[model samples]
Target: MKGPALRGDLVTPSDARYERARVAYWAQFDEVRPSAVAYCETPADVAACLAFCQDAGIPAVPRSGGHSLGGYSTTDGLVVDVSRMSRVGVRRAGDGITAVVGAGARQVDSLAALWKEGVVVPGGMCPTVSAGGFVSGGGFGWLTRRYGMASDHVLAAQVVLADGRVVRCSESVEPDLFWALRGAGGGNFGVITEYEMRPRRVPTIVSFHLRWPWDAAQAVIAAWQRWIIDGPDDLGSAMSVTAVGGDPATVDVAGGWLGDPAALERHLDELVGDAGRRPEIRTVQEDSYLDTMMAAFGLTDTTAGQRQWTGQNPDAVIPRQHFAVDRSVLVDRPIPLTGIGEVLAAFEREPRPGQVRLLSFFALGGQVNRVPRTASAYVHRDAQFYLAFWVGLDRDLPDEGDRHAAQTWADDGFAVIDRYSGGEAYQNFIDPALGGWREAYYGENYSRLAEVKRTYDPHGFFRFAQSIG
Candidate 1:
């Protein structure tokens, strides 16, 4: 039987737009040809698509920003894309500012909109990642240390259930569903249409970048870990060692600082003192909150309108990412110097020529840890840091052997970090190869999230490879 007519655009396989509409952020999923790509513009539009999927007995998957690392955003069935629904604004809420954002709003556009009102929310670094997936998986970024996860600021959300009902959930309205929506991960419950978030007011933001020699990777990792774990909450940072195109590996530490510029300089000096090596390159610039975020995203050369995923905007500057094998772990305690060395060595071993290999550590304590673990579905509260490793194959020469080599390297490097991890991983960076994902992603909160899943999506209509149920 034919489903109800949609209130939005639908690009079928026979349509001219299907080729562009079906692509995800990563090139790896480009081969996934969905039956149709529904550009949902409202809650009703989303409901219609879901109903159509159910009526036709075809699978449906939500795509916002299409940034799922595991490529869950695209499937062979139906792709319900919310990118066209994007809208963002800031308004006064009693004594605080509130951001009203469409679930499809990109992080860059949201940041720019809120900065105009002198307010901001914690969010992921990638500019094109949409709010729906990011917050649902517990978003974190440069402002996380000072403001906490993006989901922490959520005041309410509008969701379309599996049964075609549109409802708003918050602390007081559908509280159980609200709790699960915050961090149970996306695509498990229902489709999120909008998000109401509490925004933080900040005028000054200092962006800093420090690069050291490749040989200093271990020392820099150890010292940066200690610096962030001991530093004030005003600081947010991430350190990474990357080797692209078989070039010599390089170590870099970069992030934002909410405190005064002089204080941030002193903190950098302390980091250098601890690492016992002066960085070969250092840059510290104080800019407006929006500009600082733009710089962090490496969008300094592009205007706000151009900083988007390809095909989303004609003038978009960011290209789609290449095939990659990515994995992550949450560390409750800092890794000792020896462990850091071992991990660095693992990154350098059996290097795939022309493949991009990287290991990154994002500091996770401070305001994020101040909240109790059980306060929301995001259970990595006590973790001191979030560590991730990935191997990206060349976009032009993505050979079968390169993929195998990339996967092997990622698994070996991840194993090294897993020994020091707290058996927890970031739900946002979902890994298809991950074992015991339920426990690794949600920990003790899995049961609660499962219960909420049953209560809202009783028929299990909404599910993925590693859904809550």
Candidate 2:
């Protein structure tokens, strides 16, 4: 069947820019070529694209930051690229501030804009991630412990539904749709045009990083789990074990505290002291909330187009281009010491040259758990921490065998941790290989989300491999 005419900028496979337009952040998905890429400029343009896809019986997917780890953003039919729709503005509301962010706005640009107003919306660390997917998929960041997930701050949204109808949803209007939008709204129910988010006042923060030798992995992991589980809400941290190619593994802990430098230092001292191993490298600095965010993004170097602060070099922006696969699980209880050793052993079993392996534990709880599981579409509120196993091969490597090996290692690593994960997963880090995803991602909320899906997207128009319906 012939597809209907699309009004927005359409790039076919024959177009000169098709190759670039069709590419996603993860190179593993580059092989999934689409019929065409449509850059939607406005809500009307989005409607037009969806209408065309429906008329011609073609699948349509929305691409904002192109950061879907599961490659759900790319489709074989039509890709609605909203990256060009990025725009941000602020307004005063009673005693607080609210920012109207375009769905396509990147995290860095959004942060820079909001910083000028001395406010911020908790978001992911990656700069190029779009507000659309990040917020809808339960976004988290430095302020997460204090303010909760990014989805919690959303006040309203402008969504273009499956029937090509634009509607406004919020607590007072289209409340059911608004509830679904809070967490699992990723490309399933509609195309979001804009988000009205409540921003919190930027507070002074102390950012720190500490590193210990790989041999202390067990001790550090044990100590970290005990400390962070009961840590104050003012603190948020992540512990990771990483190995690049055949290099020795290293354990690193990094985080930020929304308080005085001296207090943070004391806390860090206790953390290290508990682990019974002094870190070879420890660095802590007090900076404005904006600078701390910049540092967290690995943007402390001078670079073109980056605004320079008084004390630091221009921040360097790294493009998201790599061949990687990640799988994650939510930990409700502390993992046993033997289980932790088993996880480390899996990484040691397959040490592929030129492949990077990372196992990360992101601290959850605090205000994130204060919200009830049934309050919104995000159901992992009771999880203590999120565990992810990531494997990345050099994109330049042409050997398919090496890529397959890296993927296998990642899969095996996840299996080891899955045994202790309480069978819960974060919806944001969607995994394609995961079985029983409906229960894993949404839990009891799946039924309601499916009902919402049926109401708004009865035809199953907006869908991917693991879509809600």
Candidate 1 positional error at 215, Å:
1.1
TM-score of each: 0.97, 0.95
Give lDDT per model, in order.
0.88, 0.86
Candidate 2: minimum summed lDDT over ten consecutive residues — where? Answer: 307-316
Q: Which stretches of candidate 1 lie over 4 Å from their true place?
A: 1-4, 311-314
In model 2, which regions exceed 4 Å deviation?
Answer: 1-8, 301-317
lDDT string for model 1 (1-469, tens) is 2334777888888888878888988988887888888899888999998888898889899998899888889888888899877889976758766889888999888888877777878878888899999998899888898889999999999999999999999999999899888888499999998899988887878989999989988888989988999999989999989998768999999988998899999999999999999999999999888777877788986876688766767998887887888988999998988898899888899765778888988988899999988889988898989998888887654878878888888999999999999999999999999999999999988999999988988989888888888
Q: Would you list the clashing residue pairs of candidate 1?
A: none
Q: In the order shown, what is each candidate's alpha-carbon RMSD?
A: 1.5, 3.4
**How far does residue 163 in candidate 2 sit from its true spot (Å)?**
0.6
Task: Please give, for residues 64-182, the per-residue lDDT of candidate 2 as tens digits.
Answer: 98889889989999999887788888987697678999999988888878888888888877877899999998988777888899999999999999888999999999999999999
Clashes of 1: 0
